[model samples]
Target: MKQKIESKIQVKWKACNHGLKPQACQHWLKIYFADKKVDELEKAISKAARDPAKYGIDQPALERRFKWTRTTMTQVVEYTLQAVVGTA
Candidate 1:
């Protein structure tokens, strides 16, 4: 006998800030720190918050709007994982 395993993941973000939600910011950070852990994610967001231009955030004010705390990042990751697993 043989067995097969497969998985698929899909994510949807609400239409807010022209799709620039915190989750979206996380994704943007992920593009740069693909193999990094949550700590790195927190660091990246923090850096972006301070210097939005470096992260390609054109709107200077919006940089401070994202919830860049470690707790928020952890929650976002957990929520995303739950959503993916729920879909599977």
Candidate 2:
């Protein structure tokens, strides 16, 4: 499955290299990173959610720093999780 996805991405990248599929190439690449961020956020939240961690330090810190709500953070994580895991 991983190989198949990589193969598809390689095809898209090759098209970008030829300068013919700019929009499709850019869109998939952007989605790839966005999905990656979701996995990362999930890991961070898992770590902070452990014992001796009542303070808001992980994803919450990022949320506070960025001036967003806890709801938005969870929503983004859910979106990313569905994008990555759902596709698989």
Best by lDDT: 2
Deviation in angstroms for 27 in model 1?
Answer: 14
Best by TM-score: 2
lDDT of 1 by residue, 1-88 (tens): 0011111121232222355467655653453243246557667666776777777775544444444444555565565565445534
C-alpha positional error of residue 64 in candidate 2 after TM-score superposition, expressed in Å: 17
Model 2 segments beyond 4 Å from truth? 1-7, 52-54, 57-88
Clashing residue pairs in candidate 2 (N, C-alpha, C atoms within 3 angstroms): none
Worst ten in a row by lDDT for model 1: 1-10
**Per-prediction TM-score to the true structure, in the order listed:** 0.29, 0.47
Worst 10 residues of 2 by lDDT: 63-72
> What digit string (tens of lDDT, one per residue) describes model 2 on residues 1-88?
5355546555666677787467766765865565456556656655655732575467566545444434555565555455445533
CA RMSD of all predictions? 13.5, 7.4
